[model samples]
Target chain A: MRHIRITAVVIKELIQLKRDPRSLVMIAMIPLIVMLLFGVGYGGGTGKISIAVVNLDKGSLSWTVLDSIMKTPSVYVKAYANSIEEGRELVKDGTVSATVVIPEGFTEELMKGASTQVLVIVDESITTISSTIRNAMLAVTYKFQQELVRSVGGSSVELIYSSVYGPKVTNLEAFTPLVIGIVLQLVPTSLISIAICKEKERGTFEQLIMSPISRYDIIFGKLLAFFIATIADMLITLMVAVWIFDVSVRGPLIDAMVVSTLFLLGSLGLGMLISVLSRNQLQANQAAIFIFIPALLFSGALMPIDMLSPSARILANLTPMYYFVSAFRDIMIKGFGLWQITWEVFALSVYMVLMMVTAPLVLRLRVD
Target chain B: MEYAIEISGLTKKFGDFVAVDNLDLRVRVGEIFGFLGPNGAGKTTTIRMMCGLMRQSKGTIRIYGYSIPEERSELIKITGYMAQRFSLYEDLSVYENMEFFGKLYGLNGEGLHKRIRELLEFLDLEDVKDRLAGRLSGGMKQRLALGVALIHRPKLLVLDEPTAGVDPPIRRAFWEYLRGLNKEGTTILVTTHYMDEAENCDRIGLMNKGRLIAEGTPKELKRRIFGGDLVEVVLQGRIQGDVIKGFLNVGDLKYKDGETVLRLVLKDASKELPSLLKRLDSMGLKVQSAEPINVTLEEVFIELVTKSEARVRGEAY
Candidate 1:
């Protein structure tokens, strides 16, 4: 409650911030890297793709289809292997995003007026990408089948391929900013909190408490140092997206900084909250991870909120990451303005307020 | 003299355990009062409550007549504490540590600089002024902790187990420094398990299980504990308890620490020493040397703790 007491702690924290550079870079650099990983990663997807080839009947007609595939962009070619497991491993290791195996008796089947099936091995780790790619692959397979039937003088056979989501989006760009947001939010909240917890574990909290500073001063002091580090990292991640990955930051620069700073408050508040709850570094770490991981995963970061059941979707809205991702993507990708993100700011403010209100009450007198 | 610290019926309970029971204590202005007890005897807890670091479950603590928890902020203005461990910035240099704490007390500019300079010179820590506190020796660390506590020049200073690990010579030096502070009218309340340290205090508080069993001047406690003077005789071999009693011409005799120890009336002392020595020699006893010394804080501790425990069991002794 004392003004000087709180301010004194704030100054001491600044000195500590000046000394530790690694934490500074972590806050600034980590977000930028995550941004690029999401930007180039998700931005590169174009459309559904499939590959079909006829080795024996690969006469003129097969070459025409092959040439179109080589020339065509978006639909990636799935290299055929001798065994299905070999193809499956390729998908497993992400060597090939998806694989299409062409049947060996293709030429004979066409001559005998019988149909052959082409199997698509998809890596569902990214179910959206996998399903979209699978559809493109199956479409190519049907095209190849129809062409072979005409060449062999037989009746055309229609193919049956099913999709869980109809008319999927070819430009599935939404996941990138969401993933990047999740990582950025997760690291600062958990790692910085861990850093604070480490100070507690090492008995440095005693030093801080015994010093002439007050609790608010100490809390505000740490917040400044951590904020600088986080801002630097955010800038780095943003730069990588703009320069390297070509992901646009369509929002106003000042607006982005404001959002990042407010989000930083919310994140740091979460960190401080974890710090106050756990007495030791390990316990604090476990607690931080518990709070961070679920917030990121269930906060509609990696997957769509619609895919989650109604209850989980509602719960995801409660997390700060949900608003952050929504607002960040709106600003970066969707080009939404500050007025549209009013709710995100409101949510973050609430998070920050709750943390500011509760964290100090848990500020321990001593480990004993 | 005015009381710098006053606590009455101060009780601290966590769940079902009482760390500090209903206790009352007053520290006179500018007096070095020592609180002595073994570990886990609630010394630190009591100090913390007095400082307003921890809220007391019951009773009132007034620091400079400012009621605690209510006047905690004002109380913080005038109080400085050095934790049990040498709790200072271990990574920071001694100079940096002082400056940071100086800022905490709302000190700045030339006034802060002068105060810091005085502290460095007073503690003899000028030579290693820039050395990291982590690398300092136990004695040097103790000095630095004390210096940091004195940086703000608070009227009352409380130290919890300040020198639990420092050697004898350094401890003697630390006590001398504390006495110097007291002479300048800075009241100090320090806790220790070592009985010898309690002797340096103007008055002492003997605490056991959250209660102040006894409190008085060192001389008064010693006289009351012994009811007379303790006669200590240094010997080569350990004296048997029964043999010691038989050799005594006056009151009870007891053997302790490989020496024949007994308390007797001062009037019988001169006559008893010769006859006791002769009797030992006649019995072919190898008496290395013999001298009667004064009752010490160690004896007073034993006298009080033993009696207090016996009283708790309702045994009349």
Candidate 2:
């Protein structure tokens, strides 16, 4: 292992990075794009949902409850026609994603110590947000119940609800980290894999083999460039997220970088491994895209992994992105420290070490 | 100098197919050695084996007293290999390509810069030091590739068809540079399909069907090829008698052309030519020209390979 071999590989890799403009842009744009997707797409904060209020309740109690719900930032009431059909149409036409129907005499039932039902109409297809609104209404009901008991000289009433897990948030800050992680996972791996394919396409790989540089040196050189590029993207994306989306990255900023870089190492190693096994550029791209598209889907970056089946959950954890997504969520949204995500960090580190360590053996230079 | 490369029973196989078989070659250091074969004749395989780029299935290769595969790094340290298609970082500048090789060879700082500057001028690529290699003409690119190979000042240069595509003038210029390198103590093992190019080698190894059938100096190969000399005689008029047969007994003789011309193969071509010439003159045939034209490597090579191929296939020549 001559010292020159490492330097030569590194310098050559840098030159290759400079030559490939597409990879350069992919690296620089991915993280920023993820952040923008996070900021604009996810981070605006999921409070103040629009609800068409079909107020058939001709009493003060229902009106007061509706007012309290609106004040809680849980739901904003838009007056619709008293007809139930119009309320259904509001939900159907998406003039409102949801609507609440208050029956007549709803407030008087309370005075008579009678139970009154509040008919709520909503689109079930918007499941996450529908559930979020459901939870907010329940909390408002709970508060109402507590206030009613106080008003009635401390006579507590039992309330029934089917769902658990309170809705504390609804917008982009919670998902920014996941988006960033997903973009981070995708860009470096795909770019580096494609770059390796380009070498095979151009026949520069033969020159690389004949040179004194070893396999490890070549792999390392490529990984370093990709890692750097991805990290740069990750930083730009994080900044945009912070400023534009208001998805403040919590915990140590450097730790965010550490997690992003390590995740990239795992992903790029997987890509390079694919590139090494692939005979041509098209195959390499297919393999990389296969990994990346599924990763973005199953990484639990958008929807909750909890919604998936047990086997799907297991498969989700099998991906390196799952750990990174978990790390980002915990750090950026949950505002957890390094110790809080020690397990996620450990999982990511293990994946990265395994992928990078075994990549060399997988990418054999078959001159025979 | 003693033989720089001594290979015996060298054979290379790809899984089941034998690419080079039982090849034996000996080339002296400081002498230009040529390996001649048609396309796919295992010329590249042999050169690659010598460079330690490939391992032989069976054989022993000793380059300047170092065993290969185990000592590939050692050989690669001092041996510059110019591949069939000379490779370079086409994106990098001419000087940058040289500096990269120099650094890889462990020359740095002023020494590296000085050597690069010298090679720049030597290859006549001075003004284009900053120009990308891909932008250069075919001849200039070849020169740049050569300069990169010479950056380490290798003792041996394994050039696989270094002059395959350059125009005749540039090829001539390239060979002159190569000869200059050989004079400065570089052992060059070169492969070319052109027989005229083979004539420049001090000794040549003629390969066919994965075997080296003949190996000797240009003169020795000629002598061995015919087991004698090649004499050419042309006359002003045609002749048909024992008078032509009385020309030479030293070797086989044949007359051709509209006039009676004969090529005589003999052991002592120089000593026999004048006697044969005088004999032709006395025979009352007006001689147009007479000379002892030695067999070209092409003749020697065709004789050896065709005979070998015929023998292997049991064909009558």
What TM-score against the true fold does each predicted structure earn? Answer: 0.78, 0.84
- What is the per-residue lDDT of model 1 for residues B83-152, given as tens digits with 9 covering 90 to 100? 8877777767898888878887778778888988899999999999989888999999998888888887
Would you list the C-alpha lDDT of every candidate in the order shown? 0.73, 0.77
For all candidates, state DockQ relative to the true structure: 0.29, 0.28
State the lDDT of candidate 2 residue by residue for B65-166, as single tens digits.
Answer: 888767766776778777787578788889877877777677878999999998888889999999988899989988987888888888888888988978
Docking class of 2: acceptable
Candidate 1 pairs with clashing backbones? A6-A217, A28-A232, A28-A233, A29-A233, A32-A237, A49-A137, A50-A137
Q: Tell me the docking grade of candidate 1.
A: acceptable
DockQ leader:
1
Q: What is the lDDT of candidate 1?
A: 0.73
* Model 1: CA > 4 A from native: A1-7, A21-25, A28-130, A138-176, A194-213, A361-368, B14-16, B230-249, B252-263, B266-292, B315-317
| Interface RMSD to the true structure, each candidate | 3.4, 2.7
RMSD of 2: 4.6
**Candidate 2, clashing residue pairs?**
A42-A171, A42-A172, A43-A172, A43-A173, A46-A171, B228-B266, B229-B265, B229-B266
Shares of reference contacts reproduced by the candidates, in order, are 0.37, 0.24
